[model samples]
Target: MAKKPLSAWPWENLGSFKYAMYGPLAANVMYSWIYEDSYKHPWCVHILIICALRGFMHQLWNSYNNMLFLGNCRIKQQGVEFKQIDNEWDWDNFILLQGLLATMACLMFPSMDDEFPIWNTKGFITLMLLHVMVSEPLYYWMHRFFHGRYLFTHYHSLHHSSSVPHPFTAGHATFLEHLILSMVIGIPIMGSILMGSGSTSMIYGYVLGFDFMRCMGHSNVEVIHGAIFNKLPFLRYLIYTPTYHSLHHSDMGTNFCLFMPLFDAMWNTLNRNSWQLHNKITSNSGENGRVPDFVFLAHIVDVMSAMHIPFVNRSFASIPFSTRMFLLPFWPVTLMILLMMWAWSKTFLHTFYNLQGRLYQTWVVPRFGFQYFLPFAADGINKKIEEAILKADRMGVKVISLAALNKNEALNGGGTMFVNKHPQLKVRVCHGNTLTAAVIVNEILKDVKEVFLTGSTSKLGRAIALYLCRRRIRVLMLTSSTERFQKIQKEAPADTQNYLVHVTKYQAAQNCKTWIAGKWITPWEQSWAPSGTHFHQFVVPPILASRRDCTYGDLAAMRLPEDVEGLGSCEYKLERGVVHACHAGGAVHQLEGWPHHEIGPIDVDRIDLVWEAALKHGFRPVFQP
Candidate 1:
């Protein structure tokens, strides 16, 4: 039987031989399955079933691999080793599974209409085509937005982490990401079905074909379209080849079409250049592979260097206004040159500073002798402290204590009373404000084997105790202040609760009594005292009896002469002291009795000398390191 072409066809090309054959080839299959009583099962029902089955299989495969697969698979047939390729444990997969199930449910138990009428087949087919046309562009824009910086890090980052994407990576994404993509694709299909003018079967066919195409596009297999189709002027416009879609996955932000290149062409996102590049490279190499590491590194370095320039800085002050106006015409070219020069300068300087040994020796070594000296001092101090603790214990010394003075009090309260402490035992009295206290506690615990804290425990103390316990250090809290000690005990984690032992007033008194009677204790305050009358009074008899290997006398001898004078005066004043200076005539007049303010000119070097002396006496440096 000969079938006549419909006279109402919109385009004459549509009735041509190629269209006549392919159109019916698809149409006949849809019609028989849709209209025949034996095949009356709703097209929507079959689609829902297939989608569910595929989603279930995907989940099952992922679950099995995550739970059971323990080793890498070297596929002999493919001559490749797959490393860490399992996807069953991803959050994306879960969201995808849920979205698919929800979509199927929506299609099956549609809010309206149980069965679609058969009489409106043409209208239904038209609606289905329109739905696809509308949906593809929405997907393109939404997908592009997802790849943008703000959203990409939070949502799209997970997807691109898998550079060589597999089937499981397809639907594996966040719920919000999945929902956005699904609504963009699904709303059109639902809207068409509800309009009641289209063939539901045609819509179902489009959905099935679309899903299969997506899977094949992400598949490992290569299926090039026939050369004749590529050469045919009209047919090329009507269909998408595998090469068309593969380019989309390879080159991001390009080739955003699904079924046809109509929208992609209109939007200028088709990426024909990328396709050409891919074809040229693949033809030569016989493989489509990942980009090399060196190429990626070069791009990163170029980007970083470009971003490093201080664009607002004025190297432009010398140029005349008329010249600047004239240069505005070639501003883009000029700016690019300037930016490139800036990037090169920054890169060269950074590389030389970090990588060139001679530059480091000549520029850095002599200027910062403290950098080399401080580390050696720290290592030596740590070793001597450890040996001292052991020796003190062998001599029957029951307690060895270390103390650091608060920097704030060290300078302001009085002269730095404990400035010359033991050499081997490192002590610094900074104004031990909360921040400094925290830093010191953390640093101190790193070298010590055990720490026994005795004080009215505060939040800072409790925090220090907790941190020490986590590092597996044993801490015994001894304090007469029961409330603060109890707070410390309560805040500690359950596992570390036992490491904190609270000592009562009676217990502390008893321990001190026994140590004093036996002359076996070394108090931290006495151990860290300066070699002056101020700290000599506080040094307990038992501390002196212990016969320490290192003493404050050693530090006092090593001290700068100017520092000793400042300490003597600071200790003489029990209360806070101040040194005042006033300018008179052409010189500065110094006053040291009490606080007073006077305005006058001062000798700059005299002020500098006094400031240096203040710093030696434990005043904080006003400048940054």
Candidate 2:
């Protein structure tokens, strides 16, 4: 008898037909052995179970891999860090997609009725075998097509970005890849339904079985040994192992099997190293050199670039109002072009060596956000900060602190917007406004009973205004609007607003002993008001005040004494022996980053992970990291 010639067409291949028939029938894996109408369970219960299952499996799989260091690769490749990938956000999209799929299934074939008992019996077996057989051929061919040069480069490469594939990596394909992959089950099942041969149990089994098998293939665990295949020789051709898929990842030329290697064998493209590599991996070579270098796919490269668009100052004043208005239709296109140009200008991260007190290394992603001192710039800053959050999330920074414009709510909406945007950031964000405000207020209060506050509507301005107002000190509040003044006035303690003198006039600050100017304060005082008066300016491009008495400071990033904790101050020297807050909330924000408990000492670098650090040293987190 002559062996059949290899063909990409599913009908021409026995393996393809087998995969289609068997993979879906095996979907009984989606149902429980003790079956009942799934409607009996509450929707919340189903959601809870699904969440628990995914969470447990994720942690269990990752923890096991961490211990055994299974299939470890790309830890240090292209600046990728293993710790960075250890994120809660990674599961968010997967869970969402799965939930949607599940809901659709439940809707299409409501699980409310115990209408299908075959899911537990011979019916389950029949469907499992039938779908697997049919899916095999279709899946095999589709899988092969994804490996085509064009598709692989444009779409499938996203999956391969992670040199070391983890369990969740099973669903890490591009939307195009996922769309193509979903057809495997959808087509066959729909075909069966149209022919009046379809059953819910069969569909359930097919989806679950597909999920389980895909997860196993990407697990990187050598559960099926070559020795097992040595004893049970037939299983060798039928069951594809992790080693088979890993080799496919390493070099996409061979071992293309969705379920089995029968067609691969028939095509003469079977990877010979499948079993031997598994042995090496399980034994020493694979385990020893677990980490592999990683490369970025084009899409991610685009996103990383977008995350840090270089700040470029361009004057639009040359264009007439009518000319600019005429270009409004093209403004969006122009803006996007300009943004792309900005993105291409630089990389997302900046590495720096500390030349100050400590000899440690630091990395930063500049906000490049526009108008840090402007209220409306919060939108621009928020967008950039989101990118920074994701970038840091990818790089696995445990803690991040927003600097200058990024830290101000009047500028970036504070850390609240950032945290709200990335729920699973895991890494903490600190505007450090509490500490900055506290320090600046503490220092300024020592010298004056009455202080003039500018930009009172601003976040740090509000914090300072409230603290001073509550302390019963006279605060000459000046803002652009009555609404902003009223807003800050309402936030102050009872009777504190009584001590606040509403002053919309700049000259109202003339009699004040100290002036604390916020970022929103335009046409700020450039000269010393009174001979005896001193000024503390928080916003920068500092007041442009030429007076020797004016001191500019930022308490957000400061160093304190070795023995003191949050009690110490972070003062920037405006003059010799004079340290003050740079922005309205600088000192307060710096304090906000400190640990609540002061058992021993505290130190701060780029970001103060003081809460976690203090916890490790027998101190409970007052302000949790």
Candidate 3:
């Protein structure tokens, strides 16, 4: 590791408030437009707009490159980790700083007069010419110079910190490096303006194009088709691909050119295997794509959560899921994404991680939480789930764990539908409900002899009731179905069957301080419980904290193994590295190499077994405190 220099931006510690750096420049532009009536001199306003455009363009690339469906095109197979995400979180800081500097430069240069038009072909050509002559060679040398011992150790090393480059990784640099970059980028634009060839469109085009190219190079995903280089041959020297720049990060000695490989070739600094490696990745996207040891079949929660996936926004997804005011404006865009998914999308890989040397991935079905209840949407959702299972089976995946709504009993019978349909599946289909049951039951304190249980007719509920009754603990089963209650009661021995008491109303559990709610309880129902009663729930969208005195535990979840790697994003509302019990259950099954499918009803005898297995594999329960 190189020693970091004290080149941090003054505003670096300000966090998101660092965006306020744009306030002075934006106010100046707005003042000129309103009070000063300087309509012709729109240069200041254009600077602000260009900054906004570049920021948007950079985010688009970031989102697209991290998309799991497009993973095959990725230059690096390993996933981005939390450390890299933290390093790049402030990537947009450069945009604000550069915008400020550019605005000041416009004020300084008298040649940048108030006479601006919509477009200028001459200005566009001039900017390109300047970029090739000045920006290209100057940046190539500066980039190479930074790689030298002193500069690399003190400055350029920050930019190379991301082993797997993301789009924002391009902007992640020391203050001194960005200052140099601003000068290199500004020269071409300023040259066009100084030569009287500058226009509004040319400035926008050049700056946005510059950002686009930078993002493309750092995107990790190789989007440029091999045929493009093959057809032209000369384009290889004229342009650089994602693979070209990625090679620079990995090897650090070659492919130093900014946007064009022409300079690298001239200096003999280009990586010789760049083209061959690019083709290998792009061609690996078909039937013989890479396989994983375990697959977690996940689904969308709702409209608000659709954009919370790792590919959509790394910063947003890295934290616990929440509704952001900034994201509200993008709701229409999210709705469009949903419509597209409803129309053509299928099960696609959303993210993945490594645990104990095994490759584990999360493949998401294109259905939202509400869709799973639409009755009409059941078959469609199930079809997507089945397709994902069959695909995993074909890919030689060891285990496929159905998550959340994907394993709903009414929708797919807890993944039993797929396993029974394809009995010869080499890949085991798992609902992970056994571990879910284990987590819920284990949540009960050992000394508690009596408790209230809701949704007692459900699979997990039945398992919990049977398990508790065998321990001589009284489980007051809250259910309207006597037949369902009797069936579960019979599963226990006659000596303990009396411990499984069925209750028709919430009033029956008034004296019990421990409440296990598998179903959503209304305030009136919750009120029936005495004060200080704790609510441990497995209900989706865990019931709200309605009573101040009563405690509420989050949904059943387990912290992933401490050895888990590349877990960059949070799993829903749970804390980082913590996943729903069902997801962990699948992981344990894969680690233990359980031969049989864990679908349908959970076996009561296996509850303790799964719990012990999870602990053995380093999975811990989410501590309540």
Candidate 4:
């Protein structure tokens, strides 16, 4: 239950219980006289108009940005937020009610001893600007904390689900997220009021300007002219562009400023891509009908196995994002980062990517971060996955990646059963396992060259085996199927066959310095190998790595927006950690045309060649930490 508001607060004097339940409706009564022309109709009717205008404004911005892309650079090929099922409700309902409720909160705000319009009083303008200054560091660190492992899985990732953010997405956060962000603005307002230097007009100005800039930040469309940046370079220091904030979302670190770049520049937390993406977009040849087709795939948690219980020692469905937000004020649960890494990983339901028009859908899978990992959930999980893929295929999807457990095959309890189920399915199916395997090899080879490749006959493992051979790295292929194992060896080609050797036992997995395995008919119960050889486990039911000895990561490539490590903040590297992909497929697909990748089949060699092309284009793992 919500705490009872003071009687002095709006409508509480009318007996708190009756009116508390209808507070926002009460605001219509309180503020109705202020808008006499609109009073003839119900408040709901007026709100409908407001929402319509808001939506229209969003469309206008999206259209304007598409045009501006001719002369300006975009942070990504797509900046338009694809409205999703969950987000659609929030956009249509939650925001409307929240805005109506804020009418009363706005009316209750206090005034300072002296007041003046921003234009009339330099003091007011100075104080308004100071609000950003005061809020910047707090917002930065708070944002940093949110990115850390525990809070991110619980709270922050909600906002990030919309990878290609829209203007309204600034408020797509959980309740606790809203509360902390409110402090960024509140502290400055309260500070000025306490110090006796604040004014009503200044307070309103700050609030209005603060929100205006945030909308601009997420707009994905930069309205500011390039001439201003060129002629008055100093102005860039005063405020950040939308490209600045987009990099923060895509890169997951740096550019942690609120409405201004002053603190980010001073603290050395800014990344270089702000200008790179901007210049790259601006340098476009301004060709009509040449804009890229922006398509995205969305998934919550992958269906993977789990080794531990989440909060309350219960299945993840019991603890949801809404419940977590409600509990946030009372308990942050930050301690989980140290004592409960696996539990934390399975705690939150993270919708992995963005959802847009006709593409917004979810399977019958329960809302659990790690539900599919439960002992016997394979059949039900695979059924839902097949249905999702079949639907996407029927709808003319270009390519679909059944992320996490969805990629797992049901035979022998795990592998790619979907691709074979309907080989004729027109839509290209990608587990991203191929590209994922490619990137994992790069990360693993960073320290150790020799390793055991389990599931070497599987599609992903085969690609890894071939790629490793191409690099001349030694591989001990571990597989139980003799025919499949020998096939890999026989087809290994002259150059790679010398580096590849096959064995049919799990025990052989530990002989090498590192162990990289795919989903197996039998599970490797321990988090790490008993021999203490570093294990790079790359399957659903991800191996929880405490130290670096057991490392687990997803298998997809993204073009990082900035250099996360050099951005100079421990919070980001601490929160979500870092995963790198070659992004060769993404860049190559971008060049081929819009709607991203082609509709037909794509191969491992094609993606690997893109990796080579990416290197030639000066692309590398941009996130260091």
User: Best by lDDT, which number?
Assistant: 3
Error of 1 at 97 (Å): 4.8
- What would the per-residue lDDT of candidate 1 be over residues 330-414, giving only the tens digit for each residue? 5565457545643442211100010011111000000111222254543333333334333433433322222111111212221
Candidate 2 residue 539 C-alpha distance from true site, Å: 31
**Cα-based lDDT for every prediction:** 0.36, 0.49, 0.87, 0.50
Model 1: weakest 10-residue lDDT segment is 357-366
Model 4 regions lying over 4 Å from their true place:
1-397, 411-427, 446-449, 504-511, 519-533, 546-559, 562-604, 613-625
TM-score per candidate: 0.32, 0.38, 0.96, 0.40
Writing each residue's lDDT as its tens digit, candidate 3 over 1-625 gives 5445557887876877877777876777777777885644566667778888998899899788877785447677778888899888889888987888887787787656676678888888999998999999999999989999989988888898887888999999988888888888899888888888888888788788889999999987888888888889999999899988998988889999989899999999999999998777777755334579999999988889988887788899999998889999989999898889778876777888999988899988878788888999888888999999999998899999998788888888898898889889999999999998889888888889999999898988888899989888999999999999999888899899999998999999999999999888988889988999989998886787889999989889999988898789988898889999999999999999999999988899999999999999999999543
lDDT of 2 by residue, 106-218 (tens): 45665432343343454455555655677677777777787889777666676777655555677666655554565665565555544545565565556555666666676
Judging by TM-score against the true structure, name the best candidate: 3
Regions more than 4 Å wrong, model 3: 1-6, 29-41, 110-113, 287-289
Error of 1 at 555 (Å): 68
In candidate 3 the C-alpha lDDT for residue 481 amounts to 94
Across 507-573, the per-residue lDDT of candidate 4 in tens digits comes to: 6555465777665424343332544555565554444455445444433343432322111101111
Q: Which regions of candidate 1 fall more than 4 Å away from where they truly are?
A: 1-48, 56-84, 88-113, 117-120, 198-200, 226-229, 233-250, 277-625
Question: What is model 1's C-alpha RMSD?
Answer: 28.1
- Please estimate how well model 2 matches the true structure, expressed as its whole-model Cα lDDT: 0.49
